[model samples]
Target: MATSRTGLDEEFIGRLETSLDIYGIRQDPSLPPLQQTYMTVRAGQDGSAGSARLALPAFKGDKGDPGDGFLWQGDRTSAELAALREALGTDQRNWAYRNSDNNDLWVWIGSRFVISPDAFGAEGPEGPAPILVGGTVTVNGEALDQPLGTRVVGSDGVYSLGVDLPELPKGEPGDQGEPGSIFSSPDITGGPTDGQILVFDNESGKMVWRDGYLGPKVYNVPASAFGDWSSGLTGTRHIITAITIPAQPYRYRLDFDGSVEVSSILGQTVDVQVRADDPDTGAMVGVAYGNMEATGWVNQRFHAYSPDPFTPDTTGIRVGVVEPGVEQTLHVVAVKSAGLAAAWRVAGNGRSSLRVKLERMP
Candidate 1:
């Protein structure tokens, strides 16, 4: 018998010596048709015919030296990352301190302050399992440690303090449009009461009010719910003042109708002192009076007489609808003083103007 043989040696095999590994071969026909081949004495095959498959079980690798770190030109590690958290073992009210525990359990991690939640457990003999709030690891690698400076080291990595955050502060105490708490009452004769919002008429603006006889709540009865601002004839006075503490405004259009001769006493000019008549009581609430004398002006005094009676406030002031028969006029006059007999000399027949302001409350 003629022998067709191939020799096998340690040089012919690598990892295969392990009995734990098993591999096999496939046909070269599995490869593209035209090809060159080599002889494998270990598998005892003519390489021209098939493919060899390699397999292995998993294992750990040998350690190697890691390289140097990154650069931010010339910034400190913390500076490179802008900011990092720091925990204080105890509450010291310091800007950099973050109370880590109720027991003043804190650590100065790096830069910013932080606070931790109640972290207590029986994972170890006495202490609880460490939490992974960044920068640290547990004694047994069971968890991450409370990150205080440099708990983590790496290649261009980030640092985290990982303390618990508190919730945010509340908003301004205004209308919260709550369910039963929000109501709209067209039935309202006055302002909207609690829960009910009354969008008043004769006004062109909207006033929002939340429940509470107590306010801060204001009504623009002349703008939105009630009157039209665009048209010169909304038939209602655009009450120009805020329903606020000062001259809480309410508008009216009074017409005396049919001309009557001006009363001589009424026509005569009198020294005028102006006031903001309080609506609550028809008493004079002086806002500004013309001071014929005084210097170093801090506040302005009334100097010119309005040809028409007018109110004072914001944008639309001195300008609004005046209803006929429902609005009247007010007058202001200023003069020099005289004698008891010549009272006309003190507050003379000299009148500057009649300020016919419409007072509408029909």
Candidate 2:
């Protein structure tokens, strides 16, 4: 019985092989209905092969149930569509068709109608430039009208705005601020007194108040007081004019302008001196000198000045110390030169003048 079963199995295998030879495998057809069917073989958990049935349908299954459809709101104008959306409420399935003249298709999506393929219309012609009308400006509820013919022209518009604003009502005065320092500073010493001026003190590196002006003082010698002098003999000195300077620390400059007349052609020269004299002692404290050469008959114009600044000796005389209203006198004098066989004279009438300039040095 086993031998017979073996013979039957071999015979069945031979018949299966013969059938495959008779109908060989061909390429899959392009059409879905005529395509060859394949059964999927999956590996089981035990590593054994597992087969699944390949069910190929002779035709497609019956169609599915239809979904909710969009109710056509019809082709309407924008105003009409707005009215229809208001009437129909938020029915999202509702839709409307619109031609190019009326825009695109729109669907009502609960809140509003949204257009499909949202596109803009053709651009229209540009409108005329806007004209800005003139108006008044108000400040604090007070109106100020625009001035006549005052127009503000802008790039796109013209306006007439009032340039002047209405004056506001006066407000209450504010509290006064703290007093500021006029001359009271760290760099300045001593309080300001009446008629006293500020002067920088080098020793203390501060500004101090001085009794007199800090600037230069000028004194002009009176022309009427100048006297003419003539000396036939040499070594004769004559006073021309005098200038009085106030009691103060000063550097003096003496200037003399006069004409020298040489009566004798043999006269060589005449000496001119600016001498600072102590009024109390009649003693000359400082002297600066120059000379004029002889020019016969014709009066030779001469100008003389102090070679250096003259500082009065404040420590010498009682008048030198500034307290008792001390004063210093500067005298302009002319002397005939020694060893000259001539007569020389300085004419004081309208040809002689002297000026004294005093400056504060300390």
Best by lDDT: 2
Model 2 residue 161 CA deviation (Å) reads 51
Off by over 4 Å in 1: 1-270, 274-300, 303-328, 337-362
Which lDDT value does model 1 have at 343?
Answer: 21
TM-score of 1: 0.15
Q: After superposition, how far is residue 212 of candidate 2 from its true place, in Å?
A: 11
Deviation in Å, model 1, residue 359 alpha carbon: 14
lDDT of 1 at 300: 24
- Which candidate leads the pack in TM-score? 2
| Error in Å for residue 123 of model 1 | 73
Q: Model 1 clash tally? A: 47
lDDT of 1 by residue, 254-297 (tens): 22111101111222222323222333222222222323332221
* lDDT on C-alpha atoms for all candidate structures: 0.29, 0.53
